[model samples]
Target: MQEVGSAGTIAVARRPEHRGRSLYTQALFRLLTQKPMGVLGLAIVVVLVVAAIGAPWMAPADPNALASGAKLEGPSLSHPFGTDNLGRDVFSRVVFGARISMTIGLVAVITSTVISVAIGVLSGFFGGVVDLLFQRLIDALIAFPGLVLILAMVAIFADTDLPGLPEEGAISTPTVVLMGTIGFLLGVGGSRIIRSAVLSVRASTYVEAAQSLGAGDLRLMRTHILPNVLPPTITLATLGLGTAILLEATLSFLGLGVPPNIATWGGMLNREARSWMTEAPWLALFPGLALSLAVFGFNMLGDALRDVLDPRLRT
Candidate 1:
């Protein structure tokens, strides 16, 4: 390309050989290269996902099937993680439990992200009365201890029968309710982070310029605010994944989560496992290790993503 200089001389401009990589691509590259922990975290997450997806084929035995003759047997080639008190294969149950934990965590994070973004964007963009009302509501929700609030909500709705809903399926009513409650609580609290991001974007010169150009509130928000706020929101959602999984486990351990019949890591650690833990340590050890690894992996990944995605933190 040629451009005329101030002195009327022609100058040549050369286009780059290739286009720059996308933000996410660059972030991924950095995650793989610069962050060792992030790579390990991602690996763990992938393994868990694979385990959950392949549970049917990979599990050596039916997770719920009882083998009275093999009850509480120690680890061996037949059962890598040994048998539980009910003679259920601990390894099989752990693999199956991954499905439950991953599904609930993902659903809860997605739900919380939607709620947080909606509330945060509206409340922050429209300030004044709208902000006040939303903030007050958020405050009320935040005032209570999160776990206690969730416990109360779950307890109240646990036995409430819903017509036309199947008692058993890919997801049960009780499980759905549990996920929603966790999502709602996390979302309301997480809104504060999004709201702060929106406020920062709202005060930017570009936002004022957009407004000066006769852009509507919705247009400004969609074109400018939303894009800017997404980085923080994504980071928040990633971090929320670990929290959601841990919270589900806690609820299950307390006997307030999914049904006892269903296999879950937390349920595995319940009364039977606790009682037999001294006698057969593998019962708690394997499930606890799985839970710890899952939460650790997500948390590490989230931290790495936050560092990579945040402009302020970017190198």
Candidate 2:
């Protein structure tokens, strides 16, 4: 009888430890051990992030500085990816463009996650009045057509210069704010997804036990509810990255993103879109390729993460 009692106590102690290791960690380990493609995608994303963050230092040539003699040059040992119409090295601009692309994606995803998670959590946990009001608001937001909404936001906010009037080619605060705002709006779906999960989990055995034990709403929500929702939330966040990147690119393509001088992949595509397929295909091809690769990288990573983080997928 004493041994059985001791075993029960040990099992109780270990339960917290077991729950501490989220499904995400197990999924991650499974991917690393069993799936090589997921690892490759993750590696590519990391490299791109590093390159984007270190653009000024890592790039061999000035991305913006004109090379009058090198204009329209083809790919060669001297200039690997060749030069664009204005003599800016295509390779260097593409490298720097990675920064622009990634900044928008990462920032937008983070903003979206924060807003969505907060709204979703409050609605799902508290329910009643809070949930009713929030759900209505979300429904209203969703009523607007997606592309039209983004276009309307860009048209309203687009400008030739930053608000405080920093010199040309500097980081554009207004543009970033606009992109981040759009990102947050788009990210609202994440919260709704989490809210649904929360609704289901709120009635689960452990949650009811926590409530019965007199845990405060905050404690029950944060300690018991939030942790359970994190794995799927992370997966959504990862997938949302690809969506945000695509939106930014589309906005840029429509001339609604970034300033004229900034050279994001979308910006470059817009600039070079005129006659590139006929005259200089490389101009359009390179940036388009970069954008595709960025989207591809995030999507692949997200898929792998989903497989890894999703509890249902685990054997």
Candidate 3:
């Protein structure tokens, strides 16, 4: 009897480990057999992530450096992407901009995931007055026009410490404020989808068995419900990455993100493209292309993830 109990304990302990291995193996196999679009999307996302992480090493020169007489210079051997209105290296700035853009996407997705998951789990699991109140609240928040809400939040927080975060810290200034505002809105909007997924998962036999076996609500939620909801949330996040970046760019273009002195893709267009589109079309072209490519990469990756997560779409 003692040996049998020990064996049962070991099997239980190994259960999660085995599940993790199976999931990893399945994901790897699916990636290996992924379609061309999936492969291309994966490549683009990998490249962008690398560029964002290695901007300092990859940049040719100081992205903010202003060379004498370099302003409005067309693309050439020295500066492949040409010089901007401030004579800064456009190529270097663009490379550095990848860091800002990708960071915005990541922060947005993380914030969205956390808030959405909490709201979704509560709403789906409780299913009473709690769910009714939250559902209405979420709906009301989603009813507002996003752009106006973003702009309003930016204006309201313009004078606060939210935008003036120090160079080195957990906070990232204006972006933190921006991301939080956007993330909250997105979280509320996305909670409904996750709630639906949670509802489906709650009805599964495994969940019923776990509950009957005396698993607490928190344990069941963290272990069973959360994991099942993650795939769809991840897919939402991948798609949201592109959306977040685009929104961030728009804010920067309107002089709301970072500082004007900082080298952001949208800020470059706002500062240089406005005055020098004819003189140096490359100023807008390259940055615009980068933004487009970033969005395209995320969207394609989201499509690939959808196919992988849903067996019916695996053709």
Candidate 4:
């Protein structure tokens, strides 16, 4: 009898671990075999990540260096993407821009996910007054036009100084402002998705059983509700990454994101690219292509993740 009881305890302990491994394995298999777009998206994402990390080594020339003799040159053996009006290498600038875009996408998504998860878990778990108040706040934020709100916020904080930070810190003031604004906007809107997921989990039999067994609210949330809600939360974060990157590009194009010295995809287009489009089309073409590919990859991956992670959509 003692041996049987010990074996039963061991089995129960290993069950969750086995289940987790199985789920991950299934998701991987489906992502690789069932979703062609997912595979393509993953490839594009991997390439961009590698390009961003290896910009210094991959780029042949300095992105900002003036090559007076190479001004307005078209694509050639010497300059694959050609030179801009200012004589800077278009390919090098595009390569370096990948770093900025990826950074903003990753940082904004992380910030928004944290906010969405915290607010959503609390609002859904604690219903009544807490839920009502949180919902009202979310509604207020939703009332504003997202792009307009972000533009206004960026304009307001564009010149704000960050005290005690060095002039050459990895993250600058404008980057912080952009990340915070984008994160806040996406986070509040995304909370509704998370809240709905939590509401469903909250009503489940397991949750009710745990409550009946004297599980505290924190334990119920941390141990049960949070885990169940992670699928949708991850899906939301994945989708939001593309949105954040596009928003940053838009802001930069408008001359309201990052510093002028930084070479962003949108900034590349916004600078002399617009005026020289008829003469030097490569200036705009390459940057625009990179931006489009990045957004498309993220969107495809997010859609595939949603289908894989959401049981309702699974085959």
Candidate 5:
């Protein structure tokens, strides 16, 4: 009897180990068989992430530093992408701008993920008054015009500043704030999706078995429900980062975002909107192209991830 019980424990442990190995092998095979779009997207995303992370050290010169005579110069051997209105290197600003764009995307997405996951897991697991209240709250938020709501939030928080952030933090103050505000609102979508996923998972036989085995609610949620919900949530969160970045650029272009003195691709386009289109088209072209490519890469990556990770999309 004792030997039989020990064998049962060994089998149970081996089950999880086998599952882990299977998952790893599946992931490897998927990666090896990735489509051209997926490969290209991953490459571009890697480049963008590297640029964003290495911005400070990689910038040719001070992005904010102004040299009076260099203003409005076209791309040359000396000034590759030329200088902006204030004589700051456009290339430098754009490089540094990557930092800003990526930072906001990363930070806001993290914040959104945490808040949304909590709201979603609790709402789905409880499924009573707790669910009802959260559902209504999220519904109301969804009802608002997304961009308009973000702008309103930005306007409200325009005067508010974080006490601990360094002074150099805001290259385009308004744009960062707007992106964060919009990103938070967008988080609600993820939360709602997660809640629904959780609901479905709660009905699964494994969940019922766990409950019958006297596993507590918290344990069931953390160990079982959350894991099931994460695959889809990861896909959503990645795609959402691209959307948030694009929105920030749009807001910046409309003069509702970062300041002129700061250098972002969007800010650069806005500053040179009139003259750069004619005199130095590369000024607008390269930055705009980069932004589009960045968005496209992330989107393709999300699609690939869905195909690879989502059970619904799996063959």
Candidate 6:
């Protein structure tokens, strides 16, 4: 009897220790061990992140500076990716664009995840009219095309003045709008997913035991429920990053994302550049390639994460 009791106690003690190892560490380890595409994607993303972080020091020349002779120049030792129509080094602009893309992706996914998790948990745990109402509301919103919603928000808020900028065109507006839009959409979707996870775990024998022991709702969620849900949440959020970045870039390409002077991968591939694609094919090709690479990298990483977190998905 004592041996069984000691074993059970030891198991209980080790449970917390087992959970303490960082999920990020585990996920990264899994990613490293995965297929070639996963490693390649991680490598590409790391390079872009490094370039973004070191843009000021790494860029060969000013991303915005213009020179009459440098305009439409082909690839050279001085400007490896060549110069755009405006004579700005395409390499520098591409490097700088990485910062904006990464920022938007990270911010939007994180914000959405937090908001969605909170609502989903609250609704799922309580299990009453609150859940019903919130779920119904979210379902209605989900029915609308996301693009139309973002466009509607843009039209409504376009004329509104931002704090630092004038009533005229301000990049901050779209940045905020895009981040919130993506976050809200993802959060709503995530709520359903998270709620499902919560429900599945809520009925477990351990959960019932905790409840019988007089654990509060908040305690049950914080200590017992949230941890189990985290792996899938993280996987979803990482995947969502690529989508958020792509959407923001789309807005930028549509002339609604960022300011004119500021460089974005999408802005670099704007209509004006497309018009000259025949004359200066490199103009659209390089930025488009970079954007595609950014999306691809995130997607591969997300897939790796999914495979790592959900063993069922792994071969």
TM-score of each: 0.91, 0.88, 0.89, 0.92, 0.86, 0.90
How many pairs collide in each candidate, listed in order? 0, 0, 0, 0, 0, 0
* By lDDT: ranked, best first: 1, 4, 3, 6, 2, 5
Which residue pairs show backbone clashes in model 1? Answer: none
Please give, for residues 1-315, the per-residue lDDT of candidate 3 as tens digits: 012274464112211323555765676578658667767877889999999999999888999898888988889989999998778889999999989888888888889888888999899987899899999998788888888898898888766674356643324566688888777777778899889988988887677766766789999898888877777788888888988888889988998856677777888889888888888899999999999999998998888887777555766
**C-alpha RMSD in Å of predicted model 3 compared with the true structure:** 4.0
Worst 10 residues of 5 by lDDT: 9-18
TM-score of 6: 0.90
In terms of lDDT, model 3 sits at: 0.81
Please give the distance, in angstroms, between residue 293's alpha carbon in candidate 4 and its true position after superposition.
Answer: 0.4
Q: What is the lDDT of residue 46 in candidate 3?
A: 94
> Total backbone clashes of model 4?
0
Query: Model 1 off-target regions past 4 Å?
Result: 1-21, 168-170
> Which residue pairs clash in candidate 4?
none
**Model 2 misplacement above 4 A:** 1-18, 159-170
Predicted model with the maximum TM-score: 4
Candidate 6 has an lDDT of 0.79
Please report the TM-score between candidate 3 and the true structure. 0.89
Pairs clashing within candidate 2: none
Tens-digit per-residue lDDT, 1-315, candidate 5: 012264463111111223445664685478458656767777888988999889888778898888998877888777777876668777777787787777777767776788788889999999999999999999998898888987787778667665654333463445556656866776887898889888988887677766766779998887778877777778778888888778878877776656555666677677674565786677787678778988998898878777877657776
lDDT of each: 0.86, 0.75, 0.81, 0.85, 0.74, 0.79
Distance from true position, residue 189, model 2, in Å?
1.4
Candidate 2, position 230, lDDT: 79
Candidate number that wins on TM-score, 5 or 6? 6
